[model samples]
Target: MINLNEVLKTLNDDKQQEFINYLDKKNKRKDAKNIQLVKLLLIDKYSSQEISEKIYGKQNKVALHALRKRLFQSLIDFTANTCIKEENSLDVKLIKYIIAARSFLQKEQIEVGYQILDKAKIIATEYQLFSILNEIYHTKIQYVHQYKTLNLEETICNFKENQQQLIQEDNLNIAYANIRKSLNEYQQKKTIIDIKKLIENTLKTQNISDLSLLSFKSLYQLLQITTISSSQKFDYYNLTSFATETYKIVENHTSKNKQLYYHIEILYLISNIFFRNKKFHQSLKYLQLMNFYMNENKQKYLKDFSSKHDLLLALNYNYIEKQEEAIQLLENSINKKSSNVIQNLDIYLTLIVCYFQHKNLTKAQNLLSKLYHTDKWYLEKAGLVWTIKKNLIDILLQIDSGHINLVESRLKSFKRNYFKHLKDIHQENVIAYLKLVEIYYKNPEKASSKEFYNRVETSFNFIDNKKEDIFMMSFFAWLKAKMTKQDVYLVTLELINS
Candidate 1:
């Protein structure tokens, strides 16, 4: 019952109704109870035992199990059929072409079979569908002698070439998996690793230059890995160049109509990287391209990318002093229900930051309190980085609201929870920042003193302002504002511009 309900939740209302209609057509008996069970599950108004009683006049696990199984299988069939109808999928088209060619060959229709196979080979090669191309090459090699017009040597050479590519892609996937695993461990357990070095070594070993040969999906994954590494290092200057070059390769090689999803994703990624590097104008340019592509195919993926698009746009607007626009964008998105839990939490946190910058302490406090989930839940859903930001913001909010007791308790709790992890990850600066905040909290008057200002300067091992992360700078700006008695937003803008 739990598994079936989970699967059903993935479908929209229209698809759910289609699945019900499909079950009706497949039902041979007028007395079938599968539909009844699905309807009960859809409404979500009953426990398993209660549902069993409603459907069978009493709790009957055996019959309930059978009905659930039938419905689940029907859903699988319906989903597969629906996917086959997605004509934009190059892989599906290649599969269909290969199947047709095989059938024609089995019936001894030599010319038609060869023609279909040739067409499949062209597309499979164009898209770099190595595995599918391998199958096509295999069929041609098997029937090369039967069809004398076929070049056996050429078929074998293509097969070997595709085999090498398959091996290379497999190796790249393994490297990606290993890098992600290391990143997860670092994020979760605080296992120290140099993310930049790891990525560089992996790419060097893979010989991953000439991005044109990679498929859109492969390039997207590689870009994602690079993004993660750049994020950790707070250095997007090089990633900006790499991502832009990669996007150009994708743009020149792939058809936007067929690969619109990846196209939009790559554009968003480029925009985000540019934003992180504080190249606001360039970021907006890429975002415009992303928006234009999102409207393709009648806005098929608009809903999926809307939250992310608005979030990045708002971030840029906020940094560029368009606070009202940024705040409005975030406020509009905060209440919308999105399947992306991390993204939703980000929207909430960003809004809270905006309110805090505007010195609306009450609103910021209210928003922070609304994040009512447990720390474990947040860590699992949004990862340790987000959880840390939320904790830090909560402390800052309490500090500003003069909730001295709450601030003291939260500061102590944060240290107890994260001090060791931060140290392990070489983020001692965060711990140092918290110490400075605690210093100010305990003696607010001393924050403006030369001795305390020097203490702030000595506490941080400052990097180049251009290479510093924007979020870190924002937090530093808050301390600077306290020392100078200026508006935190103004200080933040100054630090970002610096």
Candidate 2:
């Protein structure tokens, strides 16, 4: 029952209704209880005993458990079938052709089977479905004697080529997994891992060259790895060139319709990297392209990517001095119920930043208060870094609001909880920033003093503005604003421009 409830939570209201209708149609007996079970689960208001009494007019644990298992299986079948119908139409066609071909061949219908296999081969080859193509080639070789028109040597050569492609795909998958594992370890563990070096070594060890023939999905995964590495270092200049070059490669190698999801993902990655590098125009250009591609295929992935798309668009708008538009975008998104908890948290955090930048301290405080979940819950959902970011932002908000006692307590709690983790991640600058915030809270007059300004300047190792992380700069901008007595947003723009 618990497992079923969890799965049902993933469905939207419409999908839940669709699932209920599917259950209604699947029920063959008038006395079927699966539909009743689903309704009870959806309401989420009944105990097992209550549900059993409601459904069976008595507390029947064994019967209730059996009904729950049946409902779970039914849900799985419905979801799997729906996914196949929506996402894998082409693959399904190819599979049906292959199965039909095999059936005909087994029945000694040689000519019809060869014709069907030829059709399957063309579709498979065009989409670079190497595994399916391998099956097609194997089937051909098994009946090669029956079809003398098929040259045995040519069939063997094609089979071997498909095998090579399969090997490359396998190697890419392994390398991608290793890179993700390394990234996870670096994020979670108290250790230093050079992610960029690890990614480079993994690709090199796998013999994956820049011009290696790869499917659209493989290329997207490669870009994902690069994005992770660049994010760790707050460097996107190099990623800009790499992502564009990879985009060009994807265009040359894969069809847009067949790999639209990956194509859209790659576009978003490029735009985000450009945005990070402060190339607002370039980022918008890629975002436009992403939007255009997303609208194709009947907007198949629009819902899936809308939150991220809107988030990036809002960020770009915010940086380009379109604060009202940015705030509006985030405001519209933040109140909507979304299953994407992480993205929703990001929207909340970004909106809070916007509010803070506008000096709307009360609004920021109210929004921050709405994130009522425990830090541990957020840590599990959004990761430790994000949790720390929220804490730091909350502290800054309290400081700006002149809640001195609250700010002091928060600062102390932050240092106690995160000072060592920041140091472990080599983010001493964050620790420095927090200490300066404490100083500003304790002595507002000293914020503009030359001695304190020198302390601020010496505390952080400033890099090229183009390569600096934007969020880090935003925090730094607040400190600089205090020192220079300028608007923090304007200071932020000046810092980025510098």
Candidate 3:
């Protein structure tokens, strides 16, 4: 009853979109579970199974049942322009306010969301959705206030208290927990292997409804670990099969409003994976998609783009033989953000690599100069710092005349003075050993020497406790045979023949 027809008659197109959007934004709709089901029911009324399949991938029975039930409960009334639903819930009404807050928050506006969330906490207390209500604050709501203006230590401290409340409420939701863990590991400068395991575990959990997105991510994480290890323990085709299956799940759900940022994040990972594996074509495809989504969504989030994207975009373009585009993007990013050392060091190192690749020695040299001169956040990571320096030295020696002899002599002195730098087990981490191997190999004067193999052996020992491929074993075997004047090539040839 309740004059539902009159309500429908009064509302205009924009108002109708507000009703539709109640299920559009991810965090809001996810929090308002039943109302979201109602919106999906409305979309299902206008679309078919196949149309849904094409858009998302497949219809799920649970989702199908929920949609059908909600549609019947609403009792869709026909009109020339608009349709109306009866019996909206307290959850749906609250969801609308949350939506308003979220829109402001996204526009780098936070005060309005804070006021709206204040209203929500009372409704949340009344409705017993305290856990998710805490989530709204911990995840997005507070970030807007915290980042909207200048840094506020007290505001951040209070936000942390709220975050603690969120996690303590019911041990936190899986997605939120996984995100926290992943972020912590990233901040700690953990290896690809450790991060991959966490990402895989996140993807493996069957709780994820967004299959296409989650599967795409799982494959992306696995691909990263495989890249540095120089081995493929997982099958790409099988992962693609998982993707095809997950695409089926993609059909079950409508595109969430947050997919813009989430999609960019996934595609960035895919682009990196492709670039690393030398799959230039697939790399370009993902990169183009990333550019499309990120360009559209960039202004909505932070203004500065992910520096990794710019660097990787350059690398992708280079791989696809688009040198000009690659160099152009690299220059634009560096020029636009020359002063933003407030960001990660990976961006600086990546920029150095990008400039070097484009044959712009001046730009590359300038970046290297700034890297040391700039007091950027290097995550207090020594290995990362060394990676940047070694890469810069390698590039400088390659391009600058007479720098080669100087670099060689510097390295020779380094090998003697820093033989301790090479010999200390803790100092000789995997990356450190790899840098030494690269230095020895590049020096030409050092590669054939027995001492170089000793360094390589130390490197392998660093990998001893970790999972590794047959390639490492084969490499050491070849090295040992060479050191002992044995027929290493013939022995490896027989291994291949056998």
Candidate 4:
């Protein structure tokens, strides 16, 4: 997870500086070292020793300790004030309204108290914040006691409605939580058989129905289930149906939805589905739509949304044969900092592949150097696909440069690593592809043989038309092109487009 200071900075640099300045003003202090400490924290490079040296010219751990405590409290106070002023976030405004209502009620300002409560109630209902609505209803009952002029019957009825809403909301929240937990488990070695059963049980147990009404959270959960099922079962039609219905739900309720982040996330999920189905044009279209949402609310989402948008859009560009555009997009985005280590690795590996495919060997080599120097902890955590892809790109670069000895050495290391880390048919298919590359390197004269093509197809017949490994589709196409003596680029394009 991203640190709090970094998340705040990503929200707004100017705002963060203003917050620091506000702290200085409140303290009536000038040139505060703690202010600089706050700045360091925002960049995620804060060190007590560095701060102590900068402040006192020697190690003073005691002073640094006091400063850290003060700075943390100052940040909390600043965030509280800032959130109250941010009208764009309904939750923030709802908090402010609730606070104001309580203060007004204590002061015997009955009209103002009721007015504030009314506003908060509207916001809570609009956002489907049933928990908050329950709080509002309980507060209303107290107000009714103080101002007897209010109708008790109406207040009691509203309270009952809120109680019913709370029950429904609780049920939905629990169902969604369970589904997310199962998805996390599915990311491990667990198969889709158990996951599919879990989904069915959740829907029946929760009384979730396609024909009935649903909340935004429930609808999003449904889409997630459909996405996983579609990928595991290769059922694109069900994915399309669910995704389309989810899109319509978002559109229909856009006005009242406070969780607009879901809209962007759903677009990403839909775009990925299309990409996996090899519908590049449709995938690009949805990505464009996702970009429009990100741009429209850039300040609130730019830092979070930009990285994912660049990655998927670049991938679509790569598949469409717009290599320069793909390379440019990935290169620009890869140099920036991100909180997600796994995502960062994905972007770097994708960029390396794009550079290799674009024939920019020098650029690819530069990225490879960075990967080699990266922390081994990250490399280990990046999982099997990353390790295999990185080594393959290295081998491909060697093949392109005609370094046969280097290629042979790397191939030996690659096979060793693959067998040690991966135990699946996918691993075997990838190693087979690498071996095929080695064969071509050793015997270029056999490339155009029809017999060679037949043998190559038979060698990896188990992996043919297997949608589980979309990452290898282009490589398979390149191998096929080699055997048929066709343009590698054209064959790759045809494979993805097919």
**lDDT on C-alpha atoms for all candidate structures:** 0.86, 0.86, 0.48, 0.71
Candidate 1, residue 364: Cα displacement in angstroms equals 2.8
What lDDT does model 3 reach? Answer: 0.48
The numbered model that scores best in lDDT is: 2
| Best model number under TM-score | 2
Give the poorly placed runs of model 1, Cα more than 4 Å off: 1-6, 12-46, 50-58, 87-89, 254-257
Q: Please, what is the TM-score per model?
A: 0.91, 0.94, 0.43, 0.77
TM-score pick, better of 2 and 4: 2
The total of clashing pairs for model 4 equals 0
Clash pairs, candidate 1, are none
RMSD of each: 2.6, 2.0, 22.1, 4.7
| Candidate 4 residue 222 C-alpha distance from true site, Å | 4.3
Clashes in each model (backbone N, CA, C under 3 Å)? Answer: 0, 0, 4, 0
Instruction: Judging by lDDT, tell me the better candidate of 2 and 4.
Output: 2
Candidate 3 per-residue lDDT, tens place, 1-498, comes to 233333433344455566555335423434434444444433444444643453345865566555545533443432222222322345566777788777887775667777777688666644444454655555453565455553456545655665554443333245445554544444344532343454456445533333333322332333344332222231232233343343344334244223444445656655555454445577677677766666674354234345656777776665455667776776677565532343344555555555554446677676666655321234344233344354435434342423455565545544543445334323344345446545644664575687877676666443331123222333333434434545543443333223
Q: 19 in model 1: Cα distance from truth in Å?
A: 4.5
Model with the higher TM-score, candidate 1 or 4: 1
Kindly list the per-residue Cα lDDT of model 4 for residues 1-498, writing each as its tens digit: 224465555445567779777877887657577777776776676565776787778999888787777777777887777766653467766877888898999999988898899989987877777778888888888878788777889878988977766666577667667765655443342432345677778678766665225556656666776676655443454466567667776777743235656667878888887776667788888898888777664456666778888899998888877888988888788777566767788898888777766667788788877876432454456643456667777787777767788988888887765554344423456666777787887887776777677768777745334243456676776677767777666777777656
Q: Name the lDDT of candidate 4.
A: 0.71
RMSD of 2: 2.0
Give the runs in model 3 whose Cα sits over 4 Å from its true position. Answer: 1-252, 256-258, 295-308, 338-347, 354-362, 373-401, 404-498
Instruction: Write model 2 residue lDDT over 421-458, tens digit each, in one string.
Output: 77877889989998998888899999999999889889
Q: Residue 121 in candidate 4 has what lDDT?
A: 90
